[model samples]
Target: MVIADLLGVAKVAAITLNERGRISHWDDTATELFGVAPPRALGRPPAALLRLPREHRGAFEPGGFGHVWCGACTLPRVDDGEPAEVGWWVYPIGGTPGERGVSVLALAADLRRLRRDGIGITIGDLLLAPPDRPAGDAAPARRPAAARLLRVEPALTEPSGDGADTFAA
Candidate 1:
């Protein structure tokens, strides 16, 4: 299926930002996922709507690197409901950061759904799952320094059914 169709069914919401970081494209999945309408979602900084914390801004926010940024964050409920854990992937469009840097962001409201469907959302060595792979299969090992800070291991995200981590801390 095309990416648009994929986003619609994958429990993953995607948004696009214009050069100035203003909301540009908020897809149907995003509207339902965030509970925000186009009028409210557009022209606003994502941090304001997504409830990203200031302390972790460096990791969650896009930067000059143009690399895909992925992280796990608890998002505030739009209607004062229970918060939810959302996995986010932010990719910068331009080669360098500046006043004009468009980006496409994908947020996974249900990582397990993606994992169950055999997809691993990744950044550096953070997440290693590939599309449609069996969740029980072993993912590769490439430990990034950030992995330590994130306290992430393959087994932490994907259990081998025995409840033991493949790579122990």
Candidate 2:
């Protein structure tokens, strides 16, 4: 559905953030969802408008921002009514992080309706949080130092028609 929305097969609210993480483009759909027109939304960080949690606050930092998919997050409406749960995707464009002219495209959809449609969508669907640990403890299950430096690529080869798949790297 996210892919469909991005391809124009479906419609969703869209916002674009500049390299410095200030709003650059705000679409009508965005105004409908957030209840803030482009005049008030532009030139401001999303955190200043949305009720973003601490973890998601990094989305406004160019140094830490990356391609992120937030399956469900609550954002307060402009009228201060019940919060709206929505799913969003953030993707950088033009250049990589720290590069000039880089901008981010954010697409958001209402999760309540998504659930009503029996889509079975869940929060943190695409995000994998690091395992929690007790205080002052090293992370568990870390790869060996040597393994961290290793690079592996699958070898491409023609199928031999043996009714089995083969991969070598």
Checking candidate 2 for backbone clashes, the offending pairs are none
Off by over 4 Å in 2: 1-9, 94-102, 117-169
The regions of model 1 sitting more than 4 angstroms off are: 1-9, 59-66, 96-101, 112-169
* Per-residue lDDT of 84 in model 1: 62
Local lDDT at 11 for model 1: 45
Q: lDDT of candidate 1?
A: 0.56
Best by lDDT: 2
User: lDDT for each of the candidates?
Assistant: 0.56, 0.59
Which is the leading candidate under TM-score? Answer: 2
Model 1 TM-score relative to the real fold: 0.52
lDDT of 2 by residue, 46-98 (tens): 99878777777776555566656555688787655568887787776645633
Name every residue pair that clashes in candidate 1. 118-132, 120-129
